[model samples]
Target: MTGNGRRGRRILAAAVVAAALAGVLSGCGGPDDVSTATGSTQPAATQPSATAPVAANPEGTNAPLPEGAAVAPSPTGEPAPEQCSNPTASLRPFPDGAPESPALDRIRARGRLVVGLDTGSNLFSFRDPITGSIEGFDADIAREVARDLLGDPNLAEFRILSSADRIPALQDRLVDVVVNTVTVNCERREQVDFSTVYFEAQQRILVAQGSGIHGVADLAGRRVCTVAGSTSLTHLQRAEPDAIVLTVPSWSDCLVVLQQGQVDAVSSDDSLLAGLASQDPYLQIVGDSLSPEPYGIGINKYDPDLVRLVNASLERMRQDGTWSRIYDRWLGILGPSPGPPVPHYQD
Candidate 1:
């Protein structure tokens, strides 16, 4: 065939092939199918209708828990005090020079403080989406410890930990210190030492606004959520034996379940619940405190000197108004600074 004739035939063949391909694509979905940018077609019904009212529970049932979320086993009995008289008291601050210890020496040699915390914790320690940097009350406290130890706050390395992992991380020496919102108790003192109480929180309940679940009294027969391995769980079980308790990996998970209608309420520290409630205007914290929750920095039990050093830094922060500044910056939603908790020292 002549060159022009061959080119014409080739164009005709290409047109036929394109038409066949189009026919096959159109056959794959119904008329209601929507074309996606990736060349895939999805049922238009999957797309939410503009006029369809959103259901609180879309599946007509409780939403599935997030991965790793679990229902806590029923409490066997009230937990014993383990002979702890004053869990809030901690080692005295180091006098003046802040003498060095093996733990401090190791951290100095490493040149940075390895601090463990939960980035999922909203007001305490969470990541900033825009900045991609961790910013919260606990993060700042960890930085202060780094500043006192390494002479630079930026030298601190943050390690994200789960609620159940905080104690193990410290016990295993995985992190130099844990600035997570850990309650100091005699049971915990057995495994790790703690800095003096940095923040005093009170346990409370968070529920949907006007849920008629005013307090712990209303929690009976209702599903409540809290983080696993938390003091909140213990207190909750004791406060209301009839309530169904669901435990998740983080407080954020509790927020998720609450929003999905999987649970009626979330029980935790008022400080933590404030963070959750702030994220969703439909939620509110209700009722008086269930119990006092004294937060302390977790240090390995073997590191008494490091504990003293951390306590010293906390003392300086309290006196210099750094604590108040941090509180006002992150927790102003909870109200005015209660002024940093009075430090109790065991001389």
Candidate 2:
């Protein structure tokens, strides 16, 4: 049993490293780099997507393969032969269009909700072995949005994107909404509209087990890892200004780098930091959350109606206890509800 366990860990470790390497190769290798295109399921959006569609398994016509068979056991213990999967389905056709939101009507008339999302974030939208799905908390949120707008969550098509592309995705009409973990900022507002804040996050530091380093001050000259498309990249650069940051496409990969001593620490949102910490007890989240990361849904600047409708839906979810249920389902450990919404904004 011990020997098998050790083998499993080794395989898992190699898989993780490959994932990290793939993130880098994708950008530098281009078409020749098939790993990032194939290895990492969670694409980097530093902020990113709603639930995306899956091939076959559409409407469950052909029953999904047994979950066990779907995943081949990896030397790492993760069953494989099973490719990673997208969290949800494409947006279903709403040919009739939503009369409630004029912007949605326009979008529907054009066909497809071009959703911009992070292709490489873990636990939020990373690859899954059993079902080859891009399953995660972030993807779940996107799934719900696609369900609401497309009348069928399966109708919305997701486009992998990065943090820098959040606003640009909407501005360019490449996407109808950016379900990425986009923080609401003054500058961001200049380019696009935002839904009421959905998640309240902050930057926290993550260090490997037994590492003498405790906080940002220790990071002055040490190497750190942050997701490639995140402001965290810039944040680390500005804070240390001299610290080495080995940026990867996803936080999961960041953890691998830390485990391998490739980087000293990984800094990102508090929830994410907490999530990463939970994945491995050795890694710890330290220091107070330094930056407020109030996440909002992104929409085109030309689409106020869509934003309003989404806000109304969000409010409905809150009022109906749906939001709380989801929270308990996924984030009960975060703490109890703070109270009713603070009422962030209106059209």
Residue-wise C-alpha lDDT for candidate 1, range 1-347, written one tens digit per residue: 56466445444543432332222212111111111111112211222223221122322463444545444555565665656778889999878856667888999999988888776689998877766678799999989999998899988887767777789888888888999999988889888999999999999999998899999988765678898779999889788755667666679989998988767899999999999998999999999999999999999999998999999999999999999998999999989898999999777
**Residue by residue across 1-347, what tens digits does model 2's lDDT show?**
36656455545644543343332322321111111212344433222112111112212243321111111112222322332232111122233434556777776776656666654555455556665555566666666676676667556566666555567668977777887777766656667877777777778789977787777767644556776556666555544443445555456667665665656788898777776777787888887655677777788887766876666666666677766666665565557755334445431
lDDT of each: 0.78, 0.58
Question: What's the TM-score of each model vs. the native?
Answer: 0.82, 0.68
Candidate 2, residue 155: Cα displacement in angstroms equals: 3.4
Q: What is the overall TM-score of model 1 with all chains considered together?
A: 0.82
Cα lDDT, model 1, residue 198: 95
Best by TM-score: 1
Q: Which prediction has the highest lDDT against the true structure?
A: 1
Candidate 2 residues lying further than 4 Å off, grouped into runs, are 1-102, 110-112, 333-341
Candidate 1 pairs with clashing backbones:
none
Candidate 1, position 308, lDDT: 93
